[model samples]
Target: MRTLCSSTLIGEALLIMFAGLVAMKLTDVGTGTIWAVSGVAILLCVLLCGAITRPGAVWVGWALQLGVLASGLVLPTMYAFGVVFGALWWCSVHYGRKIDEFKAQRAAAEQAAPAAA
Candidate 1:
């Protein structure tokens, strides 16, 4: 779960950086605001990666997604990008949990087989 989620977050961080650059090129928004927003997004990404094992971290992850979506207020293009990344985040969490469950089941089965032998 941690591994998969972290991988998705790394992708998200890259996207945020790209969005920042694109916004710089396309929007009338000041460079300072763009930098601040991008910096916050990147910082949240780092926090998400580090806090994977901590309690309530999932909520923080969700908040970060909301922040991404909110960036659309500054750069309208971010609305589309935010939705795309939001779906990706959902997949990462949902499928990542499934993968973790499968690993646990496989480990349990292996242990049981050894015990039976």
Candidate 2:
């Protein structure tokens, strides 16, 4: 969970930076304002990486996804990006848990084999 989630978050941080750069060139929004919002969003992405193991962190990730979708009002392209990244986030959490469960079962099986021997 941690590994996949952290990777997704890092990807989001990079994408947010790219979006900020594009917004600066294409929109009337102030540079400081754009960067400030982008900075906070990217910061949250980074911070959430560390919190991925904690309770409610998944909800936070969903909120971030919605925020990205909302950004489409400012930059129309963001709606597509939002959906793509949201799917990635879902896969990370879903398959990551499956992987974790598999690892746990493997470990338990190994332990039981040793005991049986």
Candidate 3:
């Protein structure tokens, strides 16, 4: 579970960094400052999702998704990416918990089997 969270953060950070580079290369307003800000946001996202164990990580992820959605107001072309990320965020929060529950139940059953033997 920890590895999953960390990998997710790393993957998102790489993707966001790539996007920032593309935006800078393609747009007239290629502000290095914007890319720097995004780097910080990506790092924070990594720390929040990977290092934190509380519900705060989930909330922060959702907020980032919302920020992605809001970006459409300024960059309509990127709306699809934001929508997909939001959907992924939703699934991660929803299904990830269910999987965790299943793992706990499986572990409990395994521990009980040895006692029964």
Top candidate, metric lDDT:
2
* Clashing residue pairs, backbone N/CA/C < 3 A, model 2: none
Which lDDT value does model 3 have at 77?
Answer: 56
Q: lDDT (CA) for every model shown? A: 0.87, 0.96, 0.70
Per-residue lDDT tens digits for candidate 1, residues 1-117, read: 798789878988998998899899899989899999799889899878988768888778888888889989978887887898888888888888899899999999999998999
Better of 2 and 3 by TM-score: 2
Q: Over the stretch 1-117, how does candidate 3's per-residue lDDT look in tens digits? A: 444555566666776777777667766655776577677768777777655467577777777777766656545655887787777666666677788889999999999999999
Alpha-carbon lDDT of model 1:
0.87
Worst 10 residues of 1 by lDDT: 50-59
Ranking 1 against 3 by lDDT, winner: 1
Q: Which portions of model 3 miss their true places by more than 4 Å?
A: 1-5, 28-30
Q: Estimate each model's TM-score.
A: 0.91, 0.97, 0.80
Highest TM-score: which candidate?
2
Model 2 per-residue lDDT at 94: 99
